[model samples]
Target: MIEFHLDGRSGVAPYMQLIQQVRQALRLGLLREGDRLPTIKDVVAKVAINPNTVLKAYRELEYEGLVTARPGVGTFVARTLNEEAGAVEPLRVELRAWLRRAQAAGLDPESIEALFATTFRIQLQESA
Candidate 1:
């Protein structure tokens, strides 16, 4: 089960944030195939979000072939994005250290995110 959180200041739509969180969880191996997602009612209770919003997010995920919804049951992961779950912890530890160093160097969260996004895009382009 995944716990949902909202960042109101993120400038992203709540539903898209939910979808992104699910995708991230899949990538991190936190949600594996056949894992039941939290119920829409559960998400509404936890996040105070509208049920329709949760539905839209789940529908989008279903359309992406990442998950499936069972009527009267719950949504479930259909597949996973984590091909190398074993590699995650080491990379995450390195990322945490890098984040700490970035903070110590006076980079705020937004700045660090911007820097990382830019670098990530550049890396993708270069690799491609």
Candidate 2:
């Protein structure tokens, strides 16, 4: 079973967070076909989020063909999405080191996160 974690302060919508987590899990091999997902009731009770938000996220996943809902039971993983095996990991490691350095220099968590986001957005736009 995959447990959902919502970052209410992450500046992302709750449903998108849930949907992204599912994709990340699939890429990491943490979730595979036939795996049962947390029920809507369970998610609401555990995360204190609206049930419809979770349902909407699930619907989006279903539309993506990554999961399917089995009425009377619960949602289940359907397939794995694309995996960029040769990429991302090294950049992630470097980013982590940079984050640590920022922390050591007395930057608080929020400041570091904001700086990273700003830098990422600017870099993305520049590359485009």
Candidate 3:
């Protein structure tokens, strides 16, 4: 029941929002190995987004080695987190850049916290 939230007005694309949330979950140790993700239809319904958006996000995740998709089955978090730890540095750099941009745009800590809270609830619902 993992629920996802995307800012329709954000300059970021919906699919990119999905991807960033997954990566953020990984970084924060929220999602672990073998966690099952909702099906594309479920994600679309839950997020109130297009099915293609969910599919695109899932496909990108799979490409990044974050999850695996099986035909007739479902997408599962990959057990490669340990192996991928070395790759987190790049993500850290990207996050720093994003933080700088957010700050420059006048998004204070409270605003960022609020955004995270709302999105986290959505994620929890989707993953549940």
Top model by TM-score, which number? 1
Q: Write the per-residue lDDT of candidate 3 for residues 1-128, one digit (tens) a residue.
A: 35688898899999999988887777667778888888888877777888988899999999988999988899998953455777878988997897788889899999977876898899999999
Ranking by TM-score: 1, 2, 3
Ranking by lDDT: 1, 2, 3
Give the per-residue lDDT digits (tens) of candidate 2, residues 72-128: 988999987645756778878998998889999999999998998999899999999
1-128: candidate 1 lDDT, tens digit per residue: 99999999999999999999999999977999999999999999999999999999999999999999899988999999876878988999999999999999999999999999999999999999
Candidate 2 structure, TM-score to reference: 0.69
lDDT against the true structure, per candidate, is 0.95, 0.92, 0.84
User: lDDT: which candidate is best?
Assistant: 1
Q: For each candidate, what TM-score against the reference? A: 0.70, 0.69, 0.62
Candidate 3, backbone clash total: 8
